[model samples]
Target chain A: MAEKKVYEKTLGVMPDVISGFCPGCMHGTVHKLVGEVVQELGMLDKLVRVEGVGCCGLGQQFVSHDVIIAAHGRACAVATGVKRCSPESLVYTYQGDGDLASIGLDETVSAANRGENFTVIFINNGIYGMTGGQMAPTTLIGMKATTAPFGRKVEEHGYPMHVCELLSQLKTPQFLVRTAVDTPQNVIKTRKYIKQAFQNQIDGKGFSLVEVVTSCPTNWGYTAKEALTFLREKMFEEFPLGVYRDKDKEEA
Target chain B: MAERVFMKGCEAIAEAGVRAGCRFFAGYPITPQNEIPEYFARRMPEVGGVFVQGESEVASVNMLYGAAATGTPAMSSSSSCGISLYSEGVSYCASARLPVVYVNVQRGGPGIGAIQPAQQDYLQATKASGNGGFRMIVLAPATVQECVDMVYEAFELAQRDNNPVLVLTDGVIGTMMEPVVLPPMKTDEDIKAMKAKFADKACTGHEPCKQHFCFPGSVGTGQEIANKEAEKMYATWDKDVRVEKYLTDDAEIIFAAYGISARISRAVVKQLRAEGIKAGMIRPITVSPFPYEAFSSLDFNQVKGILDVEMSIPAQMRWDIDHAVQGRCPINECRRSGGQLLTNDQVLEGARQLIKEVL
Candidate 1:
């Protein structure tokens, strides 16, 4: 008799393959969660992802869905086109903080305001990881990035942006939430939010976004364990994790 | 025969796009071309199509990228500054080999110079549309009827070559109205069949396909190979070069023009002929595959000189004329800029001056 298999491949994900992200990078974990939710929801066949630039763009190689890579900062606009052309297909965009909140802010806000029927998974890591740890739009105050060698100052570098709160002011978005992947419980919660966002799209509710506050260990100069600790203690102090808006619950 | 209707140039082009089976249109409002998106917004729903007024020209072109990647016929329209914003997405479409159509009802510009008609973007459109030094099929229509015809033909050529096509009209023709015989509307079945032919390459998310519909940066040597293939495709476009020749069989003076400038040149050519000047006009209908053969095949022994007419100062299209003529005859520029229109009298006077100097 063969030895009992301890693990099986997640549906809609490549089997036993390593992603190109750094060792402590949370992009792989987020990609796994997205794959698991897409598989659990039975949308593997109908899922189309518009991949953004940077480490977030590497999700295409780890997932088994048809992915169209968008130019840096244009993922939401690209997703809008894909969704409008094929309304029956499930569409989503995976973007980084730099791609989503900085360069692509107009596309993000406009798509949310217009209530485009799709999902956006925005990974907010507070620093530009692929471009060598530069300051990102979501970088916290006093954070030390390559661009901010002396730590971010309020006079020069401005404060971190709460994207969920910024977008919740619009009345059209169906769901807006901020979660993290630093802990097992928070990862589970992040999965729930991701699932809800996709379900909202499937239910034809409206635009939904799940902003995942992740850690960049290489950029942060911390080990994997220290990155989780910093996320829990320091990052959470600035970006408290919770649902900012839920139109479905409000309507109910 | 389809019934003729008096329509604005922009509206007629929009209708022709719909009839050509373009079901997706994404555009941002700009001078002289806003009527295009406005018309699509009103007509797309009736034809079971999708229309989006994007946040900006940047978003509009990327939206076309997404729709076109699905192998659906998609289009966008803008003026000068907006086209500048769209340059990146246009280059992406060319590199990815996605056949999309964009119309530039040009305005004067280095940066929002004026809202009125100008042909200053000729170099930008034909020479360097975007980075990576790619080429697009650029069509310049002198009349509203030609606008409708070229727009209809542009969709077919875009799909046939799997490349981006630009309908490079100007503010004058974009706002002008005339009677045009519209093409027959493509049936729903026809559109479906056309899309089905691209099913193998389309990213409809129905099955797992190996082709990555993304930027070509990570493909290593594959990027160079794709560039070579694109270069070959561009070489084959020589047969598709089109121009309207008016009595160049035996002439001593020739006028080279396109778009609104061509209209003035046509009148100038007729006036010169009536005065027994042996003058003619060569109007380029397709500007990108710049009709070099038209100049190369001219009888140099009888030709006096060529007057390059345009609505741009410093003469943009004159460069192509210079390259084509290759010192066979002296090339002179008859041009106006900054929202100024070239008159027939001005062109005739310029032609006579060149004729007197050369002969």
Candidate 2:
């Protein structure tokens, strides 16, 4: 009898090691997508991850690849180092919002502005998860955070940072997409876009960043199911999901 | 011996780095060290290397941090305030055991004190303490020629220990023009050989190297053990402690100095000896693993006083000297600060006063 297989774990996921991400977090989904993409592209042996600081760095426990954790927000600069020296190595930076948008904005902006040939898997949850629900740079307007006890105010905390839009202003990045994994369909799309981003690097295209709009259920004060609803209802409204930059399509 | 060239101190250090197989350099421009990035910007392309003028010192050092992870021979240079920004990246490299060389072409500091030469960063450079109290072997080059030699060898020393090494130079050596015989340039094959050695640890995507390296290395599991190993590593640096004991064996008054301050002390020692004061100098070439041995080994009865000379207000290196001396002899300081260069005449006068009191 032939057994039908519906789901199987990717070998790209480290064997038997539990991730440090909180339960029901979409970080687990994103990590799975990254691993699947690398394995699908046959780049598992050549892939080098520049791990960011913050929750996104939890992939280290689960992803099977050579990685070097960059000091908070410096992953892009580190990826640039690896890519520039070994052009054949498939280099990517897995960064969280605070690491990419706030403290490491200079490094992020510079690496993308230079159009360094690399992939950036940016996980944009609205709050700081590892640090106990502090306000991240991407925290939405009026969203309550530990730093913003009364919720974010226009006069005080400023509006949420639109990372994809901000990076879109630069001309170098070849593929820029905002995708998510809360829904089954969105998870499929995230895999496709991530594959495209990694493909962009494999094709020797310029910078590619797949910003995954995800949920931090633990930090958002919601259960796993409610967080998915929050992603669909609130997160999608503040940060609309779409491909902001596609150099090939624009040229086409 | 490689060919000799008349070059500025900053350019010489850059050339020495390139010749030592450093194919990647990232640094932000600051006083007394701009020539370094400028030289790399001009020179790197010819060697198929990468040179980045980082938007900030933090970014520059982080770039080196990433590049060094792939087993690339990497170096960064900055002056006083700029190096402070590098403290974060330096700490990461030390913990990750990335062998990257750094040069602090120091200028007056303590919150942007001055643009001219000073040694106010003595404690900072030796402390190299970014976070977690990690220490690096800090090499202090006293001359432009020594700057080239020390920076050329620093990459090797850094790789030998699998740790970061700092070459601490000041404005006098960083900007001074001097004739230096450069080390032989490393070939492409040499660089390949150097990188092949780190195959086990580097993020080069080789099949054998499959693990990620996090700071504190063992991540959450074995950090205390890792910290203890780092503590043990510091003990191994005693052999790398470099200090020049100049006529200190039989002197009545000893001058303790480093970098440009040491040069002045050397000239003052000669002038003082000619005047029959029995003055000698002990210059620390490597300031981190400081030559406390120089003071402890001294015949304290013959040494009437230890004069710590520097271009800093409250002599920073005196802490090490005091520890070495163990209160055996009275320690006096001849200091010129706030961008002032210590004059040989001024140091000689200070030595004479010490001689009167001690000798």
Best by lDDT: 1
lDDT of 2 at B73: 93
* TM-score, cand. 2 vs. native: 0.97
Candidates' DockQ values? 0.61, 0.64
DockQ value of candidate 2: 0.64
lDDT of 1 by residue, A1-252 (tens): 989999666666677567898888888888888888988888877888898888898777767777888888999999899899988888999999999999999999999999999999999989999899999988988899999999998899788888999999998999999999887998899999999999999999889999998899999999988988988898888988999999877878
Q: Which TM-score does chain B of candidate 2 obtain?
A: 0.97
| Recovered share of real interface contacts in candidate 1 | 0.56
Off by over 4 Å in 1: A1-6, B208-217
Can you give the lDDT of residue A217 in candidate 2?
87
- Model 2 agreement with the true structure over B159-199: per-residue lDDT tens digits: 88888999999988999899899989899998998998876
Model 2 error, position B226 (Å): 1.6
For model 1, how big is the iRMS in angstroms? 2.1
